[model samples]
Structures are given as structure tokens and as C-alpha cells.
Target: MRRRGLAFIIVALMLGMLLAALDQTIVSTALPTIVSDLGGLEELSWVVTGYLLASTVSTPLWGKLGDQFGRKYLFVTAIVIFLVGSALCGLSSSMGQLIAYRSLQGLGGGGLMVLAQAIVGDVVSARERGKYQGWFGGVFAVASVVGPLLGGLFVDHLSWHWVFYINLPLGAVALFVIVAGLPNDKSQTRHRIDFAGVVLLGGATSCLVLLTTWGGTTYPWSDPVILGLAGAAVVLLVAWAVAERRAREPVLPLELFRLRAFTMSSAVGFVVGFAMFGALTYLPLYLQAVHGVTPTLSGLHLLPMMAGMLTMSIISGQIISRTGKYRYLPITGTAFATVGLLMLSMLTEHSSLWTMSVDLLVLGMGLGMTMQVLVIIVQNAVDFKDLGVATSGVTFFRSIGGAFGVATLGSVFSSRLNDDLSRVLARTRLPPGFDPAQVQQDPTAIQRLPPELAADFLHVYADAIATVFKVAAPIMLVAFALTWLIPQQQLRETTKAADLGEGLGATSAERSSLAEVERGLVRLADADLRRGFYARLGSLAGLDGIAPQGVWIIARLDGKGWVEAAELACRADVSRATGRPYVDQLVERGLVERSDDEDRLRLTGEGRVAAGRLTRSSLESLRGLVADWGDSPQLKRLCERITPELLGARADRPR
Candidate 1:
């Protein structure tokens, strides 16, 4: 059956991914312009880096909240938060303010991306998920190309700040669509907070991001800062694992990672992020530095990569849907990306732009095929009960990878840029007062440098770009190896209740006595017991009362045209030592069945008929006895004179 909820999820997710992915590249083209105007080029990377750091940490929190409070609400909340942050970003007056605001944006952005995908898994069945995943991939891939273009357009034709400002209205619309129409369902909530798990998870993630951000940028790998962050990460991560084992509800379910597919997919995320970002981040620089292309043109040049990604994602989704095959998609994607990355590793200052586009296309195609496919598979294999946690865990890993890639690979790029610049500057005829390091970090300085020095600096930037890609290429190979860990077991498509294996498999209809009384076909006043209601009824006519309450228990025992006296007596424990004779009297009046069993006290066809009538009467009597006082005339009159009257107050009654 088609899932009723998929459409709601798909619409919400498309918007979320559009916004999240757009943020990743939208500012790329505008970065140079923003820095030039703001005069804080030394901290240019923070605008991106701070967001990445904050967003990565926040992704898991959103996932956990989605599982706790309902994804629909959390998703809407994220959009609101993001739009607010975007508006703030547009209003920022300095580089530091922009970085702080971007960090806020990342908090919402991370939640938007992770929660949307998790919501998709919750609403759709796994086997059917690839198609939607393909759609999500298409959204992401389109954003990759369109973001830079949009950023460039805003910078060239409009103010650079419009890049952030445009998000406000789009976000408002997305939020409205989600909050106004989506069903409010907190079905996944556990009713208790996972305090320990959230604490451990947050600590673990914050430390890990710190390790990634600080290791290459702030200090050496062995320095106190790096080592301390690493140590804290390990301790918190270990504590998180232990806590999850004992937690009534966990934010980070460590058990999920034990799945081979999950492990492989997580590794794939890291590798893909490492290679993908390292390459994409520098492409704009390469265009401006080496090819002398405008930012708008650089954004336009990236369309091939986005095209490749979108096409592969959609195609893989269709293929998987048709064949029920997902195992091969990731392997193929990783392999393709690896080859493409290796090819790009050979780039030089004069490498053909068309050739670079082809390589990027190959890389994007590889990426599109795998990223969503892995998530879809992992989602499918997990029990439906853990849908939120399972989906969120994978997303969390992907974010972690993206964060690490940007920071770690960025450091590689920066270090290489520095070393290459030193070499290029060594043979220079520059005066003693000008240091290449000082100029390279400052956008205004780079723009005003002597022509030869600028050319050499640009060359250094190009070489650093190539070096990052070369290092990232090996990471792609690692991603390919990780794909092997996923078990090839076919995705077990399921419907509700399929989780109960065949050991006790039975639907409600299959194990019932299809009879008149049971089906509500028998009536006490009908004077006709269908032959079926009587069949075998005498054999088990021992029903009697054993309840602590004097009231008898009754149910339509069979679809046989009538009820059984002896069966009602035994089931409800109407004992021979007790009111057996009164029951017999009712049977004698043709109100119940009486039989020869138990000294002619057992239920017969006649007795069974009477039993249903009397039990039904007694049940109604019990119901009426307790419904005594509401709207009763006696009760109403006694309280009325003393009660305050509505709009009938007397002057003497004023208190």
C-alpha cells in the first residue's frame, strides 16, 4: 500500500534540504566580496567554519528531539530558527558578528537537514524510500550549483547581504507549509528525557569538533589543545556508549553502528565529505585565481558536477526501486568518486577547465548515487520502532564527516598554500617590508599586490587546491573500502505487525468461531437459534462467574445462532453452590439454554439462548445504576436556591 504520510514528509524535506544545501555554497561566491567590504579577510573561513562547527553539533540534538517530540514540529521550529539567523546574518555589521550569526544559522541548518531525512524514514517504508531519497538528492545537487550562482547574482546585481536576506521569505513559506498543514503526531515520544545520553552525546560531539577544528588550525596534533580535545572526545564517547546501553531512551544509539551497513555507510559519509568539500571549496578559487573567471562564471561552471549528482541520484533511486537492489549503489558511487578524485589529483594551473568539469561531474555522479542510498538502506534494515534514532545516527555521522572534511582538508589547503607561497616568493624581487603570509591572509592586500606577486600567489592557491584534492582522493578510496562492510542481505520490506515473526503470526479474523452470536447475528428475542450457535456449545457449557465482583463476565462466544448457558456459567463462574437455580429458572423461561450435563444443569440449546438475554439485561442494569445523579430533578432543585444565578442578581443578595 502507498504510504499516506510520504507526501507531507517529501515536501518538508525538499524545503529543508534546499535551504541547508544552499547555505553550504550560497556564500561561496559572495565571500570575496563580503570580506573586501567588511575588512576582516583573515577570519573569512570562520563564517563558513563556525557554521559548520555549530551545525554539526546540533544535528544529533534535532534528531533526538524529532524522536521525542515529533519531527514535524521540530522541523518547523528549525526553519524558523534558520530564517531568523539568516535575517540576523544580513544585519550583521562586522566579520565577528557575521561569524556568530552564522553559528546560530548552523544550529538551525543542522537540525533542518537531519530531522527532514529522519522524518522521511519515519513516514515511508524502507523498500520504497529510495525514490524519495533520489528526490532529496536532486534538491541537494541543485542547491550545490544554484547556491553559488544565487550568491554571485546577489553580490553582482544586488548587495552581497541579499544572499542571506533572501532566505527569510523562503524560510517563512516553508515553515507555514509545514506547521499549518502537517499532522501533529508525537507518536515516537518516550515520555521521559534521556538526560545522560544527551549530555554525553553533546560533550562527545563538541570535543570531536574541537579536535577537528583545532588540530591543524590552532596547534600541532601533539599539542595540549589537540590532545586534550581528543582525550575529552574519547572519554565522552565511551561514556555515551555505556550510557546508551543502560538508557531507557538514547540519543545516540551505539548499537546501530554494529550493523555492517551502518558502519560502511558512516565511513562512506566521512570519505565523501572529505573529498567532496575539499574539491568544491577550492573550485571557485581556481576559477578566479587561475582561469580569471568571474564569481558568477565560477558558479556557472559547477553545474556539471551538480548535474551529475542529480542524475545519478534519481537514476539510482529508480533502479533500486525496480530491482530491490541497494548494495551496489554505494560501491559504484565510491568507486566512481575515487576514480574522479584520482583524476583531479593530477590538475595543474593550466589544466583544461572542461576537463576539470568532467572530473567534477564524475565525482558528483558518484556522490549522488551513494549518499542517500546508504541512508535509505540503513533506514530500511532497522526496526520501525527505532526509525528516528536510526535515521538520525546516520545523519549525525554525515555531519561529523562534513565538519571534519571542511576543517581538516581546509588546513591541508592552507598549509600547502603557505609552503607553496614561500617557495614562489623566495625567487621574487620583492622588498623586505612585504611578507607573503601577511598579504595572503588579507583580501585587500592580495588584490593590491604587484602583478607578478599576485600571479605567484594565485599559483600557490592553485597548487594548494590540488594538494587538498590529492589528499582527499585517498579518503575516497577508504570510503570505497568501507562500502564492503555493508551486508548484502536484501532489504526486508514490511507492513505493520510484520515484526512479529511467524511463530505466533495470526490476524484477528483467522482464529475466530464464525458464528451468529459472535458476529452479533444472534438475538435473545429472535426465538430462533441458528443451528451453528448450538453446535459444540453444549460440550463447553461450563461458563460461570469467578470474578471478585458479583457482576458476570459476558462476550459473544460464537457466531452460532445463540449463546450457551453452561458456557456462560463456567466462564462467568455461576456455580452450582451459588445462584445455579436462578440461572436455571431463566433457562426454563426460554431465556437461556439448559442441558443434561451437571444434573441437567448444563446449558442446552434453549438455555444458551436465555443466557445471552439475561446477561445483556444485567449489563444494562449495571450501567444505569451508576448513572444516577446527573441532571436529576431532586439534585438540581436542592442546589439551585443556594447557587449563584446568572444575570438574575437581587440587590439584597449582593455580598
Candidate 2:
């Protein structure tokens, strides 16, 4: 496939991922409005909990299915299911209906998140994948910021129903783009679906989620229903383990745990998920119920955290890709997160939004450093055969942690709030008909209460949420400790498939040549080196005042003769919005000119001269880098022939 085609596919996948990740947070700000309209006050947490439960349970199953069938069709199918669920959710008339529809949406969401990573592993080399995975993190950050605001906008201006309705058009565009751009490679090997394993695992997960959701909320901790669910979960999980060990193909192969990298990555992922979701879920409530902010303002308040996450994620990805070192990043990240969570635990009703935002930013930085790197680590550790399962396993565990965190922390918050509210109401007189439950259910009800009662309610909520963070702080410490156990595995420069193929044949001398090429490839793949090389090339081209991006646009015009701005942006892996500024800058510099054909750009004579210099400088740099290799034509020929083949083999594999 051409570079342009691959870039388009990646964009489409990002959009699909955005659709799924956005849904996770978009409903959060709207939850109060949803409860008010649907009248499921006590059952409010179920709105998020239900979707998480279904998505978590289905994650590994979707990965296994994608591994068996082709990923393209499976991805498209997931998008379609998500869209249907989204439309149904918008049409829901009752809270129960909404919960059910959200679960249906989750069933498809599992695939959207996992398969996107899996497909990238299939296409890109491991060395180059870090930068691309950074884009995935960027998508999550963007979604985290946008989803809440969009949800708030919908709830505030349009009806909250538009939150779900908005997904329809986006999903439609993603579906069309993916079907058209993503290549399908049908699995040639026969695959046996692990029916028994899926059933046992699904049952076990459902029971665990139910236990967490209902424990100490709907039922006492010692209630027979909760006890029975807990017992059944343990039994079902054991059975699933047994089934996996004996099955022809397991949904989650037990063998993966044997790798320290895989085990540690999964463990860290779980704890990070617990801390991340637990805080994000409740922070909005703090803003609305305690600070009396509107939903829109609550969304805006989260921007600091999102900004921290985005910055650190990109920076860490670039460093990892450049240095090929990773174990310490997660460790440092967890430490930051621990400190942030500790700070958050100290918050009182008097705490300001700025203080909260700073704490969240610290937590976000910590999470950003840890989350995507762990996935990359696990993917690097596993073979191509296990890539899909391994990638999905990380997501699956993280999501499970999220479901447990929300339920368990919610229980803590509710219990503490209820006790505090009871104490406050016991000492003070209330309006005759007002129920204390209304304060717990509706933020609007707090506003209607007398000043003293409302202040008491705010204090109780603030304290309860603080207690939740206090509980989570220790878990972050544990995650930090677990990072130490992650064995320092050397990050692979080539995809697993490429590595396997190269080892299959060739003389000892040829192997030596390939080793040299591998080293060169690693240096070539360094994100910093690539950026510097491009920057140097631009300067050498006599376009020193122009930005690197503008030079890239000029180069593309020189190579392709004439292309539209949209095509240039796609090929350059930038948004059209971002590309326009570079194009305008280049036009102003007289390096590029508007073509005779409408909307196309072409290089001028000055641009051609600059392009010639850039080409010569780039070739000279490459030659200098390889100068140490003995001037053997045979060895040179082998290196040149094998490198592209290795890349092509990896890219062509039907992962």
C-alpha cells in the first residue's frame, strides 16, 4: 500500500477510536440530567457501570474474533453495532432502556478500542509504532476534553439526547472511510472459537461486576445474593482458567502471563485504570454539587488535566521511540500519580477549582506516561500470533479495573455521604416533605434546600469524594511498586513477523549484514533523528525561514508535480486545518505557487532548486552514516535488498 493510503486508514481508525472513547466520558456530565429525566435516582451509577461491564467482558472476545476472521470486516461490524446502539440510546424513553442500550453500545465498543491497536501492530514496525500509538493517546486526550463539553452543550442547549445522536454522523463517516481504505486479509488458518472459555469468562466477569455494583449498595456485604455472586465468580474464573489451558485456541491464552513484561504491564494497566476512572468519574460531581458550576464549566475545568496528559503522552512516546528505553517512565509516572492523588485526598469543601485542576494535571501526567507505554511494551514482548490477544488483554484488564474502581469507590462515596448527611439532618430541622434521598440523587435538589442544609450537603459530598481519592492513593503506590518487576526487555526495531522472516534463511555473512542494517534502521526510526533530519533538510534547501512543515509541503509538490491541499495534508499525516497554515507560509515565501488546476499546488523554480539541495543533503547524510561499513558491494547489496523486504513482509502480514 502507498503511504498516502496508510495515512488515510490511520485517520479513519482514529476517528473510530474517538467515537468509542468519547462515549466513555460524554455521558458523565449528562448523568445528572439523565437521572432527573429518567427518575432512576438510586440506580444512577448503573448508567456508566453497565457500559463498562459489558465492554470489559467483551474486549478479549472481540480481539480473538478479529484474529480469527479478518480485522477489517470485524472493525466495520463493530462500528455498525456501535452506531445502532447509539441511535437506540438516543431514542430511549426510560433509564432502564438507556442502560440496556449503553450495554449494547459497549459490546461493540470493545472492538473499536482493541482492534485499532491490533491493526496498527499489523501494519507498522514496532520501532515506528510508538509515534503512531502516541496519536492514539492524543485521541483519548482529545476525546476526554471534547466529550464532556459536547455532552454539556447537548444537555444545556439541545436536549441530552443529541449526545447519542451526534455519534450517528461521525460513525457513518468512520464506517465509510474504513470500508473504503482499510485492507482486509482473510485468515487462511482454520480457527476454532473458544465457546466454553468465552462463556465461563463472560459469566465470571459479569458476576464480578454485579458483585461490585451491588455490594454495600443494593445489598449488605453479607447478603446471600452478594455472597453467592462472589462465590460463583471465583468458581467460574477457575473453570475459565482450566478451559483456556486445554482449549485449542483460547480467547486469552494463559501462556501470556508467563512473560514478566506481559504480566507487569497488565497489572500496571489495571491499577492505572482504577485510579484514572475513579477520579474522572467523581470530579464532575464535585464541580457541580459542591462548586455549583454548570456542566459546561465543569467540562472546561478538566482541560488542565487533559492538557497535561496530551503533553506528556507525546513527549514520552517520542523519547521511547528515540532511546528505546521504557521501564522507568511508568515508574516515574506512577510516582507523580501517587503524589497527585494524595493532594486530591486533602481537598475540602473550601478547595478551589484551580487547586483541583493542578492536582488533576499531576495525575493526568502520571497516567499519560504509564498507559500507552505499557501497551507498547506488551506488544513488543509478544509474537505476532499473540499480538491481538496481548493488546486486547491490556485493555481488558484496565477496563475491569475501571469497573471495579467505579463501583467500589462509589460505594465508599455513597456510604460516607449518607452517614454525614444523616448526621447533619439529625441535628437540624428540614422542610416537612423534603426527602434526604433527594439531595443524594439530584444536584438541583441541593440548590432548592436552605443555605445551611445545602452547605452541609456540599461539605459531605466533598469529604466523601476525598475519601475515595484517599483510598485510591495507596493503589497507585502498589502500581508504582509493580513497575519494578517489569523486566527490561529490549524494544524490537522490527515487527515480530519481520524478525522471524529474517532469521529463516541466509548465510552467516548475510546475517552480519542484516544486523548492521537493523542497527541503521533503529537509528533511522528515531523520532528525534527523523525530525532533525527533516529540519536540516529544510534549512539546506534554502528555505530556512520556512517551518519544517512548509518545507515538507514544498517537497511533496516537487515530487508529485501538482496536488490539492487535502491530498498534501493526508500524505503529510496532518490535519487539513494545520496544513493550510504551512501552505500559506510557503506561498508567501514564493517557494510554492498555485497550480493552473483549481485547488492544486506546485513548486516554483526556487522551490525546485531547494528540493535539489535537500535531496543531495539527505543522500549525503545517509552515505555518511553507513561509511563505517566496509566497501563490499555484496554486503551493501544485501542490506539494501533485505531492509525493504523486511518492512514489506511485516506490513503484508495478516495480523
Candidate number of the best lDDT: 2
lDDT of each: 0.61, 0.72
Q: Estimate each model's TM-score.
A: 0.66, 0.73
Candidate 2 per-residue lDDT over residues 1-655, each given as its tens digit: 6768888888888888888888887887787677667776556666777778777677656766777777888989999989999999999989899989998998788678767756775665544655666566557666866777778788888887988998899889888988887777744334687889878987998798778777887799999999999999999999999999999877779999999989998898888878877776788777777887887788788777766766677677777767878889999999999999999999888998999999999998998788767766776787645665676676667776777777777777777777888898888788788788777767656766788768888788889889989999998999999999887676755321121101100000011123323433433544423444456666776667877666555555655577786776666666778677777887787778886554788888888777667656654554444444335464345444333322212222111
- Per-model C-alpha RMSD: 18.7, 10.8
lDDT agreement of model 1 with the native:
0.61
Per-residue lDDT of model 1, residues 1-655, tens digit only: 2334446546766786678768877887777667656755435556776676677656556755676778787888889889888999999889989989998998888778767655665565332344454465456656765877888788778897899998887777778767766666647744455678867776776687567656665688899888988888999988888888887767656777777777677678766755665566667766765666666887888778777876776677667656767888899999999988888877877788999989889988898777667666665566544554655566556655666676667677667776777787778888678866565654435556777667777667667778878888888888888887777665432111111101000000010111101111111211112222222222233333322111121223212444454544454444545646555454555434445454433344644553455344333322232222233343233222212111011111111
| Poorest 10 consecutive residues by lDDT, candidate 1 | 500-509
Name the regions of candidate 1 deviating beyond 4 angstroms.
1-17, 35-46, 63-77, 111-141, 172-190, 431-438, 442-450, 494-655
TM-score of 1: 0.66
